[model samples]
Target: MKPRLLLTLATVLGFSAGTVQADTIGDPVRGEQLFKRDCAACHQLGEGAVNRVGPQLNGVFDRRAGSLASFSYSKGMSRMGADGLTWTLETLDAYLANPRSLVSGTRMSYRGMKEQQDRSALMAYLRTWSDKPQNIPEASPTARPTVPELDPKILAIQGDPAYGEYLSSECTTCHQRDGSDQGIPAITRWPQDDFVAAMHAYKQKLRPHPVMQMMASRLTDEEIASLAAYFAALD
Candidate 1:
């Protein structure tokens, strides 16, 4: 679906957070399927869920955005939480339809799910993991990761750290030289393959951040390899 269509659909659904109903909606079974297909790579749910690329979805209902102490959220998401953005049914619906429309600089890699039914199903599945009055043991069937693997040839590229240092002047503006996460997450000390994969995701527009996409789009393959090498070596 076109980006504009997704944004428009988000608006048309029209469930304001202030007046949202907490009642369960949609089929959980179908929601499970949708979650496995689209969400398993980044988010985990049910009991004992831990942080992955994204925060665990457990207890997300009515939770403030970026509230997890363990997960490193984007500046945008943290700011939203500080401004009282809670994840109610309406807000989730809007976010699912168009993520960037809700949190512009969010690092969530997946493009938003555009179909309303699909979004409803996914949210329903996620809601099963939320805290409830009844003491129910959490259980979620394991699902395989859905992130696409990179080509072996791409992974084999050798990089020059000196060239990477030359390129890194642009990167260090947002990412700290001292490896502390100020507002942006720390990029220093990442493994080369993982760094390459993430940059490729942005370059291919598989990830949703516009600024990242723009930056990655202009870089040649070797430059990305060099940047990965340089960052990986940082103490």
Candidate 2:
């Protein structure tokens, strides 16, 4: 095979494997649980749920920020609304990651939700009340941290296969013992480079699925490499 052709094939395969494991939606049940624990004090979800510290959020979807008729909005928020910014899944994800970063002096005092999975679940829960929930945006192929960039460095580190074997138990719950595709795809016997790339894609949010993002985020590079080594040897 030509050198250029091999490189192209590798790149395509790397991204294809990563994209296959991508997840976009989250468990709404988990979302509701997170909301009740984290946001219930300030925001209300049900129709009869009235505004507490923050305004009632029944119609927040696609509604301009700070434009709620009955509630008093901060100067920053009002300015944002006047500028025609509406709440969509994308906007909400950004805002929830860091409110002050998005809008400089918002009255909401709670610190932003830092976890991507948590934000995704919260968004799902919030959408239940929205008349028109924004659809999950398609993940672009060029998002970032491609296989060529991230794969080699992690693979360079020596990984402990025994520890990885211990870690593989939880994975077996979704990925079958026989490594057969049963709705969810199997992760066994993946090439080390491809596995590293896929995990990085999830951790970097290049791939969708907040749950996978969260799971990937929790794993260190060494751990990922270890798992890769373990799975590669499994075949």
lDDT of 1 at 107: 90
lDDT of each: 0.81, 0.77
Of candidate 2, the 10-residue stretch with the lowest lDDT total is 139-148
Put down candidate 2 lDDT per residue, 46-79, tens digits, no spaces. Answer: 7697878998878576788998888888999999
For model 2, the stretches where C-alpha displacement exceeds 4 angstroms are 1-24, 132-235
Model 1: CA > 4 A from native: 1-24, 133-235
Per-model TM values vs. the true structure: 0.47, 0.48
**How many pairs in model 1 have backbone atoms within 3 A of each other, for residues 3 or more apart or on separate chains, i.e. clashes?**
0
Task: Name the candidate that leads on TM-score.
Answer: 2
**True-vs-predicted CA distance for residue 195, candidate 1, Å:** 66
Q: Pairing residues by index, what is the TM-score of model 1?
A: 0.47
- Assess candidate 2 and give its TM-score to the true structure: 0.48
